[model samples]
Target: MKTEHRIRVLMVAAENGALPAAKVGGMGDVLRDLAPELAKAQVQADQIMPAYGRFHRHPHASQLARLTVPFGGRHEIVTLYQLANPAHPESRLFLLDHPLFSNAGDGVIYHCNDPEPYASDASKFALFCAAVAVALCQRHLSRPEVLHLHDWHAALLTVLRAFDPRYQPLQALRCVYSIHNLAHQGTRPFRNSHSSFGRWFPELAASLTDAQTRRIEDPSYPQCLNPMRAAINLADKVHLVSPSYASEVLQPSDHRHGIWGGEGLEQDLNRRHQQGGLCGILNGLVYPDTPAPPQSFEALLNAMHTTLLGWQGHGTHLRNVDFIAHTRLQLWQQAKRPPPSMLLTTVARLTEQKVAILCHRLDNGDTVLETLLRRFKQRQPQGLYVCLGSGNHTIEAELQRVAAHHDNFLFLNGYQEQLSAQLYRQGQLFMMPSSFEPCGISQLMAMREGQPCLVHAVGGLRDTVVDNQTGYWFEGDSLEQQGLALLARFDELLEAFGSDDWQRVAANAKEQRFGWQSPCRLYRHSLYLE
Candidate 1:
């Protein structure tokens, strides 16, 4: 008899499957990319999630099992769906289907209802934890050696395993709790967990009460222990998204002003560090299966020019524009008019972290964009600009106004993955001027499409974007300086790359791999898997 060798990893996350259905930021993209890579890497990784309403059911998404999950003194019979791949047949994803929780349009994870009563919100995730425990006990799948949990949404698994013998056998199980962001700690009243678990684990009531009292009186005892805090407190190993973010959280800082953490979370971090906790890993992305290096500036510009001029072929145009209208449709059409003579794109959530505000001309309420906008209005504009994504309503409106005023500017209000890939392939350059970033996927994806990144030199951007080699990097966050620098770099690229010198840089950018191969290897090593 031959023994089969496979490492089963149960990856617990709030969101997966598709984008925009429930994604607020990069975490959705991370899981989507990582899941496929895990399969390719030969790890039998299965994802466990609440079947938010957004999840479109496939034929294979069958009702695998059923169980009465306890929630707030009531038991709800939750149907668990097993979405299996037809090719693999055996590989499956477990989805907990509960109308109370899963009815979020497409069955996806929603950010916590902070002020609203998702009356059954806690119960919803609690049921997920219970389902995982039951799933293990029933042997529906092979026992996983690792229960990898992401963010506070799934932190309860760590907490439950620590106290409940029903989960104690898994105590020997190695748990890796990934903290995507530290800000959204799932802090509920300690009494909620106490009361919720009272019937299940009566012995913890006294401890919970004491903790609650201390939490109330101190106001600093980490009120209610959200997933981020709980996972850090309980997991055998803890990991942050990036190395720099790991350092940043320990020493808190004000937005763009300076480091403010003289005595913030430093003490807490030191205490944890002393106790043999805390690690950081840079997030990785799956490189697209497309080869799109620029042969020459003229070729690149010609393709872009065609796309701008409503030309749809010659490898420069998108598959379709209707799909790209997920953001701001009217604005997208306006910007796509007259076909841009030149095409430059910056697609990201309009947030301060992205430093998109810097792109706006602040002087005379006329931004650096004013010049770009003016160029678009000219009979022969230098380029057409396409900015996709939604964030700060003020910024969205401002960009919309800029697009409305200019003939060659398109602004999308939200995310559309296919359109983004199309734009990535078509655009000449992908610009990101984030003030600070942990590990940006956009730049890596852009590079994969043979589009060089133009970014401010900071954080992960600095780590990825090589100056004058792979892409352009600006010094400061100043709008005028960065804008001119970006334009200058692009023009220089045009002049230099009109020859063959650009090929080396393009090849270098393309060759710089950001795939799961190396990162997954690093993760395996970190977890003592050779």
Candidate 2:
């Protein structure tokens, strides 16, 4: 009897949540969940990422191979290590380690280079891509039918496959590039710098044809190379995270109108779409058979208080945000009445994309958030608004200022997984007014917990949320209009809270299901098999 063969796929990404302490954001979550689901469909999935100077230290990790890779005009030795994935024992997770992988610092997966963005990170990923290419050429890891790359961090492998003669064998494999975020394109000088393409692969850079250069060059800055654009152009398929986002990127972005589209690569993305090389598939979440029990309002407050104490740590002086959060938690605990009728919660990274609208100032010289707090206080004096996140110092300062002035507002300046989970379960409404979202996991998590959300109607939010049903969504043509629309929607939700209509919405939210089974089937047919 003949046995069937399982299709093999190798995923290269910057972050993988399957391994311990390897995640930073949604990309990590996707990498972690997608592998096991694909396995259920009889596809063998293998994963690789930079060790970030930590994974190799795992007790079960074993060194697989050591290779000398050609990078930045010299040979740099990198070691490949394999660790057993306890979560999915059938899958393989490989980590490539080198001193440069820890350029920012040991165990740091990302870095912010102030004067020049993506400088240090670009070099690190460039070396990593080169090492991955060499590993495949030397058969350190089994070749797969599909080579899956995630985000701009792993995009340089596509460039190496296209330009470098030594890595020409990689060209035979089908490449699928997933764009988690297009805002960061990883553009850098093509020549005359330590981190330049010419420095990394001198012969290949010098021999590139004008047409080949055009394919990889940054649309806005011709002198620079954009790995995102290169991947989009060279990969067999270009994938957007959500259906709505895929359509949005075909048009040029207009920031003046609060529109975030293709950032400057609309033409390139359009060509790919025309060629049938583009796809949009919504991300999925794992739904456990036994869902965790919902916490009571008082339990939520206690969790927040305990998490705040942990964040406060052994410092002699508590940070301003921590102090404010501590006081707010204490005040709520001391209250003798029932929990507030309205509990608003948000969990996100405080980047411009996530919180810019909340920080937008109205004509009356008050931030949208401040105005909302003041109005919410007027309607429900006992109401509370809690936000948990940390990013962008400027935004953090602005949020802290709002917390200081509003007695009913609590801003937890650090993230704790347990507390966030509680916030999702206990809150009456979840808020996510991102300027643009590529398929948000937070909204899905909140909805899974039966908490209705108030989100901006763009990207995945537009796809997942239903107005006046599962959740409330608002949209506008300008930033000010968007802010005002959010305020208007909040007022409407407040008026409808606790009504029979609102309860139905909550019930519908809980009934909505977004699992990995269907998405994995799409991956098998559309992304991997096709």
Candidate 3:
């Protein structure tokens, strides 16, 4: 294919096929949406991901090639698979398959042990980077004019391209590295693998002494030399998931809490930008069907209206207080362990960043549920607490136990795409107490579904949720405040559902359109493709 005939773009993503059959985090959602959208825009885009066992592969998928990827004085044979995009069957996708990396029991990628199947994860990715360069050099497939790297796992490709002469000839090819979440930088001890930089920078192994290696693995910012940071230093342009979030990282300003483990790294990031590197690219969701609210929201609203209004055909009144009350009651009844008179939904990872623990955890080390349950126990609590998604086994287990003990609480351990859409529609308000967020899609989807978001004012959350307008925005990092705010608004929302004010907010949220068309255009502009 002629270079000009197709806007050849290759996206290197770490979380694309992650969790296979299970929809895990936001990154996978991005990959799922982006490639197909870009293809629709006439951009010939393809994704490269590890062939995970969890992935349901298509039979016609072609095995592209086989090569031994060197890692820490050892070589692992990797098989490359090619398939047209299932989402947009016309678009292409490349899967890098390695027996050692993915051929574990269930074909999941978590095969780390001993020398760590992926222990040299950084090195493993380094091999992938080298392979990408080699592939580009050989011109065995489509020549990508833009190499898009997502998060830190793929950042190494930018570093390798900085020096790989084979790819240097494609000087027109611009490197775009996106910081999905700067906190999870892929940094580890650089084992002296022959096919690795040890062959080029022999002193690399010496530099990473025992002490230094240990420090890098530390979760602390000082101990980490994130490859994402290195990519920022090398790539022509660095992008964040959202414009507002882009602004947040520029200043953590004590407001960011919980989820922000690598706090000061943004300071260093700003310094790098001063030298001319970083930029913000707001994350966008694909509106594949109808560009309308998911059916789940409509169904939930109908039930609420019918229960509260008594005279309802459909809750035509924008903010019908009675309708909201009815809705809450219905939801409460459906909740496994309903609360006294209110039901709140929080669907996110059960981590501190997600504020799952903070909101649910009690001073006695039990959970907020115990406190709420205790208060409502005498009243046969009308409220329900439903949690969807998984993280931190301890947190997940605790949440499950709470659900089991309390009829008001319901815990869904894994992610369900349709269920997520339903939650956005059915839930009165979406809660995200993340210490810091890089433009969360859940909140955006909630708003679009006419469900208000009650989020902490940090990163993307700060940018999207308008305080008192769209939903609620808490300034502090405290989950207690978040839970309180939801409770405080509960009665008002129910009493004045048809109120013009609340309706305006829901309408505004519904109108807030985020699609890949504009973002893809930005990519074209950034790369000067037009």
Better of 1 and 2 by TM-score: 2
Rank all candidate structures by their TM-score, best first, as comma-separated numbers.
2, 3, 1
Name the regions of candidate 1 deviating beyond 4 angstroms.
1-5, 18-25, 39-42, 54-56, 85-90, 111-127, 137-141, 164-166, 187-224, 256-276, 288-339, 359-380, 391-395, 475-504, 528-530
lDDT of 1 at 338: 47
lDDT score of model 3?
A: 0.61
> After aligning candidate 3 to the native by TM-score, how far in Å is the CA of 492 from where it should be?
5.9
Question: Residue-wise lDDT of candidate 2 within 334-412, one digit each (tens)?
Answer: 8755788689999998888898899999899999999999889998898989999988889999999999899888999
User: What would the per-residue lDDT of candidate 1 be over residues 1-530, giving only the tens digit for each residue?
Assistant: 87435577888877764433545567766765665566655566677777775343655577777876544445667677777633233455677776756634344455333343332355456667766766666676568888888876787787667755556777877888877755455555445543233433335434455643342221254433443555676777777666666665676555444232212344555455577677667788765475545344344333333333342333454533322322333343445544445567777978656745355454456666666456434533546667768666667666666666665666655666655666777776677867566677788888877778777675567777788788878764354556566555545654564346566776677778766776665555564242
Q: Evaluate model 3: give its TM-score.
A: 0.76
Candidates in order: C-alpha RMSD to true structure: 6.9, 1.9, 9.0
Q: Pick the candidate with the highest lDDT.
A: 2
Clashes of each: 20, 0, 23
Off by over 4 Å in 3: 1-6, 17-23, 40-42, 53-57, 103-124, 163-172, 191-225, 252-262, 288-343, 356-380, 477-504, 527-530
